[model samples]
Each structure stands twice: as C-alpha cells, then as structure tokens.
Target: MTEEEIIRPENLVYKKPTLLNDTPMHYCPGCSHGVVHKLVAEVIEEMGMENKTVAISPVGCAVFAYNYIDVDWVEAAHGRAPAVASAIKRLWPDRLVFTYQGDGDLACIGTAESIHALNRGEHIAIIFINNAIYGMTGGQMAPTTLMGMKTATCPYGREADLHGYPLKFTEIAASLEGTCYVTRQSVHTVASIRKTKKAIRKAFENSMNGKGASLVEVVSTCNAGWKLSPEKANQWMEDNMFKFYPLGDLKDTATANDSH
Candidate 1:
C-alpha cells in the first residue's frame, strides 16, 4: 500500500496531540496519569487555548505534569495548586487557568487552600486526581484512602477509629456555592476516557466562561502503591474505588453543560 493511502485521515484511528510535548513520559506502563495528561492536552488543543492556558501543578506524582503538557506552567507547593491557580486566574482573568493535583496534595496538606478557593468562586478548573493511596510518597495513607485499605503508613490497613473515614472532597466541592461544576470520573475504559475528556473540556470552558470554580475529580488507580498489576489495579479501582468515588456529574451549572 502507498504511504499516502495508509496515512489518510480516514484511515487514522488516533493521532498524538501537539499540545502534548515530544518528551517521553516517565509514568509507568499502565499508569492512567499519562492518559489523563493526553486528554488535557487534547482538550486545550481542541479549544485553541494552548497559548492562554496556564497549568498549576503541585506535589506528588503529578508534580512533573508541567513537564508533559506544553503550556505555561507554575509549580506550586504541595496542596497549593488551587491557591496558585486562583491567583493566576485573577491576575489574568482572560487566561484559562487550571490545576492538576492529587488526593494527597489536594485532600490532605492543601485541604484548606483547596476548600477556600473553591468556596470563593475562583474562575479556575481543578483537575483533582484521586488515586486513594499516596502513590509517589511511599504509598502512604492519604485522606481519601478507603477505610480498611492498607498503606505504608497504615500497615494493618486503615482503621476508622484511628485514621478516620475517607474524605469526599468533590462532594464537598459540589455543595459549595463558589463551585459551578463538580464531577467524578475515571479513565480506565474507552467510554470512560471519552467522558472524562468531555468533563475536562467543560471545566476549562467553564473557567473561560466565568462560571467560577470547576472541579473534575478523576478517580484513578496506583498499581505500584496498591501492589497490583495495571490490569488488576484498574479492576480493583472499578470494584472498590468506584463504591467510594462513583463516576458521573455531582454538579453542573456551566452554560455548555446543557449543550453537551
């Protein structure tokens, strides 16, 4: 077959997004972080927001997120992504600003910063990645770690009596008046990946539309931390994590919400 015949747009099933840099990803094989990063880049490219998009990436495995996504980036302290994004959004209200954070960073050390920023109705999209346990931080018990889930910090499994219950930060975000959109999603399946991209796109659109704080909580998995293979990790997430962090929209007031 001729190269032109094989490379036609109709024949192409997929193409790498330009917003995703040429750098090789450091994420492990089967890591959802890589997929999520691609989704974000695709959304930005589709919206033509590459130049205007400013991503604030905080601590944890996602701290190096700025390395992958080709856009203006600001590295925030652990749990300070919301605060940083809030400032950037305010200083340049016309710019599309967002934060990519993990459970340990958003729900734990930066809980107050995340809550207040969302409560105040900042025009920012918060892409919160909830992987249950602290993945990059030695698999420690994060605030969103399910009860009875074992971790490096909780060797015998998390006990409600000592560790407390898992925090539903996204649910809280939905309840906050400052937030205009809040949803929980995953990137394990092809269908779920499409939904997540839509959710992320809506979030960025909301920021540009001045819909206030929009949070898209992606319920992810950590195979290394969970001591499971990528396949088992995804399966475990579907079986157990979904119960605690179910998929679907928790809240939506964005104008584009009705359109798609």
Candidate 2:
C-alpha cells in the first residue's frame, strides 16, 4: 500500500493523542512517567475536556508535565499540589481540576494537604505517582521507599529503627469518607496500562461530576534512581514493589452508587 493509503483514517490503527504536544519528554528511558502521561492525555482527549481541564503540576520530576500536555496548568510549590488543585476546583466548579504529584511531594511535606483535601471531599482528582525513591533529586529516600531499599540518603537501606516503614498513602485515602474513588494501578505492562487509563478516566469523570474526591495512585518505577536498566526495573517492581503495594481498587463508592 502507498504511504497515503496507509495514512488513511480507515487504515489507521492508532495515532498520538492530539492533547499531547510534540514536546520531547525529558523522562529517562524506561521511566513510567511517559507512559502515564500518554494515558492522561488520551483520557482527557477522549472525554473532550481539553479546554475545561486544569492540572496542578507538582515540584518533582513531573513538574514539567504542563509542557507536554496541552491544558491549563498551575505550578504548585513542593508538596502543595493538592491545596492548589482544591482551590481551583472550588473556584471553578465547572472545570475539571486535578493534581499530578510524586510520593515525596504528596506523602511527605504535602501529607496534610493531601489528607485534608480528600477528607473535606474536594471536587478534584489527585494522581499520585509512587516510584518509592525521589527521582528528581538524586534518588534520595522518600516516604514510600520500601523497607531495605537503598537510596542516596538511605545508602544502608531503610531501617524501621531509623527511616520507618514505607507509607501506604493510597490505603489511607481509601479510608476517607470524602473519597469517591481510590485505586492503585501500574503501567509496566499493556494490560496494566489499559487499567490505569480506565482508572484515570474514572477519576476525571468523578471530579467533573462533583463526586467528592478521587485518588489514583500509580505504582511506578525509577530505573535511573535504582541504578538498574529499564528491564530490570520492571522486574524489580513486579518482584518487590507489587508485594508491598498490591494493585487494584482500595475503595469505590462511585461503583456502589451506580449499582443502586
């Protein structure tokens, strides 16, 4: 077939999301951020909420998410994305507001903000990226770092006597009454990527419908920080990360309400 014939709409099997710009992502090879970004772009575009969507970008590796996704974006201070997203969502009830945050940003300094915003049932969505280690700042230890996992700050590996255990923030989110939907997902495989995309789309839909708050935690990988190749990182995540942070929905009041 000719190039033009192959390019025909009827022959096209897949295409890049229009909401995703031509900007080359800076995420390292094998990083999960790029896959999650593509999922977000596809979900937003499919929902036809491009013009009405507002994203609160965190101060971590995903800070530049605004550059790749074509949407209204607000840069939040370190660990303050939930607060900013809450405010925007309150002021513009009609707009779809969401926050993209890392484990360090959302579970450490922004813990209070994240908990309170969800507790208060803010009409917004929180997309949490938990890669265990701090990816942007030299692979330092984060609140979600698994036990015995070594990082720049935890060179001797994390010890309960000193660093404490990894925090399961999504589990806590599931307990909150304000949370309409809380789920943990991953993007390491094609099936998981599809599920994660569905989870994100559900969260966005809940936010736009003012169904309280939603938290979608994506268990991710940091190959560069872990000093492993992309392939090994995926294997490591499946072997170790999944053991500590199992995938699936923690809570889903939305589905319950639908059943009624």
Query: Best by lDDT, which number?
Result: 2
Candidate 2 lDDT, 1-260, residue by residue in tens: 99999989878876788999999999999999988889999999999999999999988898989999999999999989989998898899999899999999999989999999999999999999999999999999999999999999999999999989999999999999899999999999999999999999999999988889999999999999999999999999999999999999999998889899
lDDT of 1 by residue, 1-260 (tens): 79998999767878888888888888877888999999999999999998998999988999988888989999998899999998989899999999999999999999999999999999999999999989886999999999889999999999999988999999999999999999999999999999999999989999998988999999998988999999999999998999888899999877545677
Q: How much does each candidate deviate from the true structure in C-alpha RMSD?
A: 2.0, 1.4
lDDT of candidate 1? 0.92
Question: Clashes in model 1: which pairs?
Answer: none
Supply candidate 1's per-residue lDDT for 48: 91
Query: Candidate 2 local accuracy as lDDT?
Result: 0.94
